[model samples]
Target: MKQSAYEAAVGLLSRRDHGEKELRSKLLSKGFAFEEVTDALTRCKEYGYLDDSRYCELMLRNGINKGWGPQRIQQSLKQKGIADSRIQEMFLDLDIDWFEQARVTAQRKFGSQVQRTKDRQVEMKEKAKRFRFLQYRGFDFEQSNYALEQLSL
Candidate 1:
């Protein structure tokens, strides 16, 4: 016997949290009827099994823990079918200090004090390297600069 959409959805949710949109997509791809998927989604939401906000929070926390900046985290959540508004709201809810996060990430990656070199070219190279790292980590200019400043990067 074929499993119902709700059963499939519940099974997926039991393994890990999934965003509403992601769950719907998965169910539809598995050949469940559109209506069945919709009904299953509604039921899941009603049962407090599927929640975009909750899923967003989990993703946000994961991103932060992994040292990702706001831009990167937002991009990831968007790819996972999370709404921009929802991502922003959850970011606000998290009350993260992005500048501080950058500093922490820098300290974690680089040492507490950057080694100074007698060569001006080497110092410039070191600064550029560290700045690029922060930028790639999704930090904005101001935030990156602040972290670099803190690290003497």
Candidate 2:
């Protein structure tokens, strides 16, 4: 038997939280007609079964737990179709300190003795590598530099 649009949407939501855009796209991709998908989404929203803000908050917490930086998390949220204004608002309401998160991430990746070596050239190379790693992990230059300093001390 074919599932109704509402049934399919509920099934999907039962497994994980989804942003409205993501849920709409997923339902459409599953062969539901646009009108059916829209109805399902509207119903879901009305019943509080789908919420972009809730999804964003969950994603943010998960990203932070995984040591992701704010830039990286922002990019991920954008890719998931979250609005920039909402992202900014959510970030403002969040209590996380990005710099502290960066510092912890650096220590976790490089360890406490990250700067124990005394060779100037080798130390420079290590610092450069660490900086690059942090940059790639989505930290800005200032945040990366701060993390490196914290790791070195």
Candidate 3:
């Protein structure tokens, strides 16, 4: 699987844009030597063919649509080798009201069920469960609780 630098770079671009680290990792996995991969990665960066920030922005939108919170999104970007500073800048730049979004999402998922509860305790528990679900969906505890409360009202 010896791919010429141009071939590998083009192959990568043909699929989707990749962050430098991700692109390099893929090239290495494809058996490109370290120096070659580095050169390819540098070339990609120089030509503006790859951008971690753009990747973060795209992933952020996707994560939000899928009902994820900032912490979860940040953690994921970090795992992809994105810098913390850039992650912060992008998160802030996106200017998302995460709580409101999560609240809306929770309401959509469980609003009808709230009306069917037979007891306050049971309802509270159910709401808590919904909160936990949002947490798993990448929301923080505070955001989850706030979302549940908003929907409960």
Best by lDDT: 1
- Please give, for residues 105-149, the per-residue lDDT of candidate 1 as tens digits: 999999789998899999998888888998898999999999989
Report the Cα lDDT for residue 18, model 2.
95
Q: List model 3 lDDT by residue over 73-148, tens digit each.
A: 8888888888889988897678778889888778778763357566888877776678778988788888888887
Ranking by TM-score: 2, 1, 3
Each model's total of backbone clashes: 0, 0, 0
| Global lDDT scores for all candidate models | 0.92, 0.89, 0.79
Which pairs in model 1 have colliding backbones?
none
Q: Candidate 1, which segments miss by more than 4 Å at Cα?
A: none
Model 2 deviation from the true structure expressed as Cα RMSD, one decimal place = 1.4
Question: Could you tell me every candidate's TM-score relative to the true structure?
Answer: 0.93, 0.94, 0.88
Candidate 1 vs candidate 2: the lDDT winner is: 1
TM-score of 1: 0.93
Clashing pairs in 2: none
